[model samples]
Target: MSKSKQELLGYQSHLIQDNLTYFKPTRTSTTVTFAEEIRSSLQEPKKSISPKFFYDENGSKLFDEICTLPEYYPYNSETEILQSIEKKLLPYLSNEFHLVELGSGSSVKTRLLIDVLFKSQKHLQYFPIDISEILDQSAKSLCMDYENLKVTGVVDTYEKGLDFIEHYDDKPNLITFLGSSFGNLDHNEGMKFLQRINTLMKSDDLFLIGLDLKKDHEVLHNAYNDSQKTTAKFNLNVLKRINEELGADFNLENFEHHAVYDEQKGRIEMYLRSLSEQSITIPKSDLSITLSKDELIHTENSHKFSISQIESYLKESNFEKLEMWFDSRKYFALVLGKKI
Candidate 1:
């Protein structure tokens, strides 16, 4: 583990039986300023920004809405598979393992696994890690619901959170990275992340990951470019975020959301395409850039995987495949494995 800009801010929730502690970040040398990241990204010839920035308050709300859209299948499909197979997963779980989740947004789907873990144990220790303050509310709710469960919520990036926890306790961990968040990383990045997790785990520690599977190009396209244009709004909000936070002059209407499934690449590419030739400036970043008509600023990529591809990823990362649960349509997968 390496040093990060993250520091632990520990506090007991008074409303509960002192069962919840939340860790908030404080400044450190490793912190990267948003302005600097935006400037560098804009200077790239590809003109792309990391999708993680799509989570400004408004963007997060919009994304929550997107999950409910009829055209969006990943959330629903994954939920279906989890509900169907959660009990079946119980036999594979260790008797006394720390329950941890990475990027644990709202912990909506995680409740299934958490509920299952409760079946065998009277008291449990759970950790939910995410960068959002939403974890605060989620932690409180879960604490109230599970009186005997102790929750340690970490508000930090996945890497820093893992670093903190790797040193905190020695209990074998059943860590999960759900909601297909891993798809945001390309193959190399995904492998590297998994390797880091492998380093954190001891033998027989468990991992559960959600992945969207390869499917028809049209289905993928519709999912990201819904008729209601919710995904469009979600995609364009990043530029709006830049304008508000980085002091950028970006006319929201001057760009349009564009998402298309690249069947050859087995991914959905999202972009904000310039509607016309325009110049933009960000005062804080000291940046000015010009875009030609239809010029794209790459935003996100949702990579869909095949079983073989996922198997190779796990095996290469030193994970022994345990089981993979899928929906009837096979549109999504929940792969469970053990660190070797």
Candidate 2:
């Protein structure tokens, strides 16, 4: 894997273990069957898939590629914003704080924040939770070089609850859910998620969230569609996953990837459109689904936000926005909120 600028800093030292236990997901055939059933049902009329399923080991890697594509503005825009504001953001962080990150994907962009924090604080503990085991291992190994950093990696989704973190001794924690991963949820669901985090925090704890700003439709569309075709492959990989896990017959070549910004919904919709009428069977679920020509199966949504809207959401979720930072173009934002 390619190391970002912050990753180089994390590797300069040696691995430090905080004696944190590794959490792994219990893989069962039922899980695969459930996924197939959900996919089949979503195709009937209104189509959708839980964006959570898009981060299997291969999906994680594909997404990393999508970030680097020239057409993908979200990754670069957010990275630029973080790198530019990290210096200022450090002053708001305390020296004794433990950094907990939600949906800590490969923890690539997070290295930018962690590196800056380690530089100023000297000795800070870290916890990164994600559902992808591959990403968890990748992040853990990368952080190994930071001798003073102790990592507690959890392989679970944020929606599943944070019971995994209960064993740890309580302290002033700085929790972050960066990369606008929260955008995967609808407005109501997103607020509920924030409320859940508010329950997890003490009065003095901090929450830093990254959000992609609303921008030109063309720019947003290109970010998801990508001229390099990486995003397309990433979108279609779901079917490949189905074939491998559930004994589904899905010809990857039979479908084309489509992503478009839905202005009314303020979200990017990803779908796999069938080039021709096709029938797919999932042996594990003992289910069959038929697709008409040009039919689409929705895959994911990336919702953009405005600063005012986010602040309102924070208030509703029992959090108060403390500070916010943005890039020169104002393409992205990193907002820090305190539990109220």
Candidate 3:
């Protein structure tokens, strides 16, 4: 970060409330309400659940497990960069800024930044935006862990979280979207998402985004399809959610978890395949669906990006790329961008 950008991020203003609160959803965070989404996705032409549905309480716990697994390298890769760059990044942030994180599941990786900021600054406000109530638990934990920080939990998606920040808060902000969750969207979707982010940012506001770097097909394939089968369990947990919430009779044993890398797409795809043709019913949604033995329901897509692609994305999003740091092997990237 340059001295000029630092001046931009060193935002100052008075808060009307000046306290922690939940921000209401201003837009469709869960595309088509939960019940409707399950029904819509299960409709014939394409049978799939948005990956966003994969983060229910149980699913979130499973994900935390998946991150620790040896086969999954994203967590470690991002953490490595944070640890290595923490010292270098301290001077760029303001003395008292709001640290907002999107999809801040567990927020284990965020501790690296938290440590750095606490040492250099007198006070910090932490706003962790997530779609789960788990953010409450995480926020509570962070409050206990840090003394100079005031932790606020924003139980909303990234889109609405930005609305809350733009409308309610006016402190210099450093927003973080970690865990390479940005890779969940495709190119066009990513561009639009970034544009929305750019729209909310102040001149000095900064965004630190984690991006998974493109690697070989085999390496990418194994990351999602771990030897421990934890990733598989994580994927199948989506059905587990439907069964629990929608009263759907989805036999866990009948659906197997599968993930593959699409070299052409530069992404890793995860699916739940039916073991045998079976009909299932979701009483809540008033929906019934039959699946062929080998039919697959796409659950998630993790898009990988090259450094050049990241630069283009930042430029198109109306953000000027400031700096990018990668892990030793360059398997992942943490990019710092300033709003233009």
Candidate 4:
């Protein structure tokens, strides 16, 4: 059977009700308006919004497009590492494993891992946790073809720290944190994030992490600031979202997308800059904000890592590195660790 048909056959009856709760937040305009009010008020000096907020339905679609662009090396590089190292990674898995994925957007890169795991083990249960509700349908529909796979999705942010941990019975888990999404958090935040995952797992459970390695500034800069301009549109879409849902009068034309490599911070910073001094009104909050020409509203940050840096992080989080794989250019890495 084809993947789609298989998905239909394996579709769980309970998932329909589950997805209702997932889609509830994004359907109402009130949530969007409130989010805008919170965003505008939070924009103090040197302020920034978390990229996790950028995964609304539209933002999620835009991001999927961004991954396909030539300039975005992280997606392709990580996919390569997963595909090439799948055979070796499969041996580490014992029987009847539960596969839990963090930030499992569309499970695009995960298909490679799933294929390998199926070959090694007879039955598998898959849990994909992501903040975007739209991904639940996409992930469930895609994984339908695998007979042994049962997919339960969580639509909460990773910062919630394992809100859905009780969904699975006490079974050995092979958890995956893919796409270098871990890079979104700073060093201290990353350590805490890993420690949280460590606390949830049994001593024998395995964890796989994908990390984008530190590369040339030019290359990293181009990846975020692509020539195709899709990333720019993706950045500005936040404003479009605010305007549509919050009854805000934001002139998308007045703002330009800006992304730069901050050498001192060692991260890629994304901002939306006003072309001229302007005042914008948000109807929901009954507030107006003034902006100076070239003034920026920070949106996102992508931090790069080195192998040694990642290893040190794992140690601090009480995870012992079992194995690691890297691409030829060493621009990306996949590290497998277990609770120490």
In the range 1-340, model 1's lDDT, one tens digit per residue, is 1233222322222223488877765545365688999999998989998898998889988999999999999999988987888578878766687788897564578677778888777778888888766644667788788877888877777877776676666777788888878988998999999998888776757888999999988888899989999999988899889999989999999999988888888889999999999999999999999999999999999999999999999999999888998999999999999888
The C-alpha TM-scores of every prediction are 0.92, 0.87, 0.90, 0.87
Question: Among all windows of ten consecutive residues in candidate 4, which has the lowest summed lDDT?
Answer: 18-27
Model 2, stretches more than 4 Å misplaced? 1-20, 24-40, 135-137, 159-161
Best by lDDT: 1
lDDT assessment of candidate 4: 0.74
lDDT of 4 by residue, 206-300 (tens): 99898988899989989988998999999998888778877888899999999998877778889998899998877765666788899988888
Worst 10 residues of 1 by lDDT: 5-14
Question: Residues 1-340, candidate 2, lDDT per residue (tens digit)?
Answer: 1233223322121233444445554433234445565656655676556666677778888988887788877677778877887667777777777777887744667677778788668877677776655535655565576677666666566644254453345667778887878888888888888898888777767888888889998888788877778888888888887788878899999999988888999989888999999888878766778888998888888899887888889889988888888878888888888888
Residue 305, model 4: lDDT of 84
Stretches > 4 Å off in candidate 3: 1-31
Compared with the true structure, model 2 gives a TM-score of 0.87
